[model samples]
Target chain A: MITTDLVPPRKGSTMQFGIFSVSDITRDPTTDHTPSEAERIKAAVAIATKAEEVGLDVFAIGEHHNPPFFSSAPTTLLAYIAAQTKNLVLSTATTLITTNDPVRIAEEYAMLQHLAGGRMDLMLGRGNTAPVYPWFGQDIRQSLPLGLENYNLLHRLWREDVVDWEGKFRTPLQGFTSTPRPLDDVPPFVWHGSIRTPEIAEQAAYYGDGFFANHIFWPKEHFMRLIRFYRQRYAHYGHGTEDQAIVGLGGQAFIAKNSQDAYTQFRPYFNEAPVYGHGPRLEDFAEQTPLSVGSPQEVIDKTLTFREHFGDYQRQLWLIDHAGLPLGTVLDQLELLGGEVVPVLRKEMAARRKAGVPDAPTHASRVKDKYGDAEPRQPRPNANRGDNVTGGSPYQDTDEGVRASLPEL
Target chain B: MSDTAPGPAPVRRELRLAVVSAGASDPSSTRMLADRTVAAAGRLAAAEGITLRVDVVELRELAQEITTAMTSQFLGEGLNAAVETLRTADGIVASTPVYKAGPSGLFSAFFQILDNDLLIAKPVVLAATAGTARHALVVDEQMRPVFAYLRTMTMPTSLFASTEDWTDPALSKRIERAARELVLQMDSGFERRVREESWGSYQHSFGSAGGTETGIELDSDLMRLAAGGQA
Candidate 1:
């Protein structure tokens, strides 16, 4: 059984600050050298460790199934990072909900939670790459229903000891108990990430889960409308008032001691940035979107405005490590961010934050919520049943009602 | 016309008309065709005691921004304003100069980038100007289908003018007919009525239609599924 002593103390502040990387292995525009896959992967590990050393609270990595991106296996990297840090909340920027089997997600993430001693959470997204869907044997056309249904099954698998589920996208499962059940029997918190899909926001709100807006590319007015709708629906579902809904936003910045040096150093990389390279002028993009490339003070000022636009959000993550900046540059970014920007922004955000808004969810908080001062149930299997099909009480402490409902082989 | 004692001025209904011209030159016939059509439409609206709030989107002025938006998905201020005009316009006059054998790439690319739901049920008059009459079919054959796919109610009289055709009287007649059709469609308030009444029936992406489609239908199948109801 897991005890209450294992849970960490609740954080003093409500907001969490961190950086997330897409793990893209690109040619450094200035040097014209591309890091090998091994080198990029190691660099990512270093970045995460540096994030913790610099006192950032969270670190997230994205997942992609194509070339130019190296984070196809985020949980593996996050688990490794989790072992190296004690306080950093390791997470995925987004885990594809449409293609991967929900059953595997339940098992893999639960295992990761146990390995990390409960310092993990996840965000779900329907990946936009059309070819990746087919590679994973899913139809992109049914992505909406597929994502929604998969999350439903995954939710039950984590909470319920036994799951008998049937859904359109995958074959039905009977008598499935995802192994290594969630650490202390407390499921990891989930945040649904969406760029422009209201259905995703509705799903997140329905479950009282967090909603993460991809607040980087498009105009704020678009994200503002989407987040407002999510907040309204979150209240409609009886989760909490609109202000209490858990919210996270994405942003990107490049910082130096002075604004001019920051701009001059980052312009070449910005001009050739992935997905939006050679498009809008850097000045126009910075003015229109959440991308801030300037002094530390400038980055902080721009980031602080997020509170006014998105209300009091719980988590704010920036994409600072992409665009093939050398690892040393990225490390310097961490130094400036942790040493200068975040300290002031944290105080400012706390001062501006309203009363009664909840802090960002963490594993320890979830465990405390479930068991309070009581010991969390750690299930132990009953002496092996001859063949593994027939289900009686699988665990010693299995509830009588649950045991009685188990299916016979 | 005889002046009479103006007592309690008539409440002239206001209609938004968007004129999108792809003419790249100052003395281009494409803009001329669009202007003639807009003037004729104005006269018809005047006959019906209506006022047209014209919003002209010259594709040439927005060429660089359009390409940028296409590549980066970042809608610059000019492109955003253009989309806003298209989103709220009651009627549209899409004028383009034919290049090679098709409508100008600038013209087609501009419409292609707009959200599909932005133009639904809106009336449009398709007009094209080409160097030779041989390219006259580009308007009806190539451009009409794009608007059709966007669900626009294109007018029956498509206006086309080549160098020689612009000098003929029939071109003006065609423009006048197209204008009358657009005015008739706009005066019926069809686009406004359809959007106001049955918008939920049509599929819309999140923040689509210039961030105006924000209403979440709680009873939609996707919403039900999102709430954990069965597929």
Candidate 2:
């Protein structure tokens, strides 16, 4: 019999399985024909929809401004997908918080929140590109500050009413408000994404937000240090114990009926993938990085090993698309993932959790309760009127003045 | 009916402006920067007694389109609208956060897909937000070069701010100064271009490249292959 102590249970039913598409519209080399941007785009939509249909929790899309990569406007793409799908949480594989203006980020996401019906979240990163900054009139040196300041502003924009703000990087505002209030009176959750930046982990912990260690490229040790640092800082912030701090991870893997066939079929594609080509051995990558090439059980076993280092996190997003693999091969991988991999993983995880082991990261688990339940619940306001309040304005003076008049302890 | 037409019909001119904010938060600093920039543009429009139609595109809600199936339609239309409006606009106020030593990936991605000629000669006011006073140089070190590459007539005065600056009065003054300079530049640029018939005519000459389709097929077979017959 399998020892329950060896495997841990998850926190909630919301299993966070995400499918990320690189958004390259190029044709497969094996086929010698590229898909139109339209077809590639449609394929992305179908994939996301299928992820949801298969009961996978989230769908993320990467952002690449260059040609062959069709996705340049991830938010606009998510909004369109939001209109078509339901329940499946929408996110970006990498939302460049470094180059884009925080103001546009605020306005666009608010609009998306309205469109997505609150099924939205984002992973903020500075990105790996160098030439992209000049294309947008920005310097690489300012990347860290831009992420920090922009995220700060983004946070306030979602939580505050009117804003009176001034900063070194941007102009000041006496009273500013982004339009299209979020659905259900709640702003979308934020997950700070980072590969090597310990600062990002610190920021996430400082704000009591989720830290997503997209471990697609780095080794487990690096991610462990970052996650551990975040957990320690989260406790420092008086939010909770290290174990209670929310975390997420990113992984990449492929599975087949047999381990050898999985590696054989995946080797060429891995060797050619623009993101990972000419870097390291596929086996090495699979060992150090989150890239797992094997059967369904292998993927499960490898993923479960994450707990040994980083402890329990709130979510896990997987990158199943890379190296311009043919759509057929990708679908086969997904089928194996959804049918064989996820089921057994879920059962094993649950069995472990039932025996008092730790659980996976989840949205509900990450919601920081700053205030105790002793505080009276506030009534929901009219959706239209909610947009009228300004950030700096005294809420007590507004139409819902009575509720806004509540005293802060 | 007169040839002179009563002193050039009072020279009716309208200023179109586009303000892009890349933050996903409501009361975000980038939005504040955009507001300050827009207010400055509004002031310039008021000084010139011109009607200004401002269009603000917030990037957070729109970022999903950067990666998903909507790349071809909604995002395309949205970007087209933004580009067309910008091509016809007199000014632009672009704001973003500095991430990983550059601008946000979403903001950069948005600009990456835009046609190179769309921003040429447009008066752009650039601003950035970061965590520390140290990161203030991103506007100059990072954002300015991108605007310059687009051949935009970027105002020399760019604003950078950090957490400490958010509540500082001096930062507000700097923003005001940038706003003032932007207006002056817009006024001079608009006047010079109008006299030479350079603004609207150039845009007309270089109308959007609605060229014939490339007829390239994204390998549906590869997509099927990638999907491994799951579809």
Candidate 3:
């Protein structure tokens, strides 16, 4: 049976590293073979499971409501993966904070947390796909406002038992309660993912949330400015020092025993990937981005440069599966990464990390902080008091009295 | 080319002027008008003891890159250089030929690729050359609003010349007035200082390919709302 509260104090290395997939089901341009949606879905699960087998820290899946992508329902997939894996933390490349109702996000992710034993975390992103807005009965013009207001509501829902939220985008909630009060009464850690917008950075810092910069195909300089803004704002808000602010970065690489073989094997997939194909040459793309197409040691040399560029980040997630690279190739790449790259990086980063920098947050560390020397609250629902979470209070212990007794503000 | 001798007292920064011309054809009068306006501004700068550096972006040359930028949603290096130059320039001399009773698509598209803050509060001398006087309103009615929306410090006097006005003495006087106003703004460093001092208050553009990061204003309405203040 899956353990419900098995999130032990973070045991392994200082840094948390893993792989995130965009869930694109592309035809292998070199072999002209395409995987069915069913096949792609199964392959993704296998890849995530292999992350645990290889002893990685995290596995994240991106959400897209359109075709050529299969990860529309992230929580469902992650819940299933939760049953399958023992130690790997399941997350999203980003949950669409703009279109998805914050109430639904709070409930669903919290539900996943209970099932996953507090081994769940999610990144929030304003998905750049413009058309997804209207389909969800939202206007693209109000994306920023909707995103901010939704998150504000979502934040309150997880922390407070009886939430009365009145925002511009959604209907007013009167004593509404999000169920399955987070596992161990610990809200999952959130990382705000952004590529270009500084307002998003400001929002992340204002909430004292982690800011993730996905350095997929862009130059390092592009993300550096945004990360710097986030770090400065994080400190400005008194969320510890700038170095203690939570950060995560995304990178991709293909590696082999020999550097030339690694480059040769990945060149075909790089040339025909859907997003970046036909734009620039592979060498140009590699030089401009964090992508490395060389030996495992070379990938380390390139990734270590990230600390030089963006200071002392906490999490590093890579894109190891996409562009129709088959499952075998992907598992091999994972093996090389887990065996070679991450082990050395852990030691190097630990030595260089300064006096007070915080490690990546986990359920255990957060719980320990919240309930030091005392038993943490595990909220059980009071008897269903006839329809309206009657008394408007749903939680068992705190504010056990009705809605009228709930404190204002 | 090593400089062994002591240099003159250094100034805060060199005045940078960018000339953007939107004429489609070679040896077009639109480019000539821009050149004249820049020359007048340069003379005024020298009179005030400011060393000036000039960069010109002929839209005729970058016509394709701007269009590609719209679809690619990214600026190529060539176009990025032009946008960066305008972003950091202390002053601008903009001239365009009127097409179909308005500014040319090539001219407007170039500006479209530039970030909204690329020319924020920079002193600008607006000049235009057209086939007839009937199209002179293109400068005041159309181009004025475009620069206004960008929040640039457009000179009080704008220079508009017809094909025939190229020889008119009135055009020369107008160019002098506009150029003198632009140079006045530059020499006083009014726009530059305002931009630097109030930069944190300006809404930044999306991409980092152009523009600098001025910290966001904590008291701004957007920041207040993002901080959970009431709508």
Which has the better TM-score: candidate 2, or candidate 3?
A: 3
Q: Given candidate 2, what's the lDDT at residue A369?
A: 34
DockQ category of candidate 2? incorrect
Docking band of candidate 1: medium
Chain B TM, per prediction: 0.91, 0.73, 0.85
Candidate 3 global lDDT: 0.81
Query: Could you give candidate 3's per-residue lDDT for residues A203-291 as a string of tens digits?
Result: 88988989999987665777888898899989999998888889999999898998889878988998788777655556756776788
lDDT, candidate 1, A1-409, per-residue tens? 1111222222424788889988899999999989999999999999999988887888999889999999998889999899888888888889999999999999889999999888888999999999999999999999999999999999998998777788888988777788878999999899999988888999999999999997999989888988998999899999999999999999998999999999899998999988988999998999999998898889888998899999999998999988889899999999988777887777777778999889888887787878899999999877766786436456777764664344554
Worst 10 residues of 3 chain B by lDDT: B1-10
Candidates 2 and 3 compared: the better one by lDDT is 3
For residue B10, model 2's alpha carbon misses the true position, in angstroms, by 99
Looking at model 3, the pairs that clash are A391-A403
RMSD to the hidden true structure, all candidates: 5.3, 25.1, 6.4
Candidate 3 per-residue lDDT over residues B47-66, each given as its tens digit:
66665677888888877667
TM-score for candidate 2, residues paired by index: 0.57
Ranking according to TM-score, highest score first = 1, 3, 2
Quality of candidate 3's docking, in CAPRI categories? Answer: acceptable
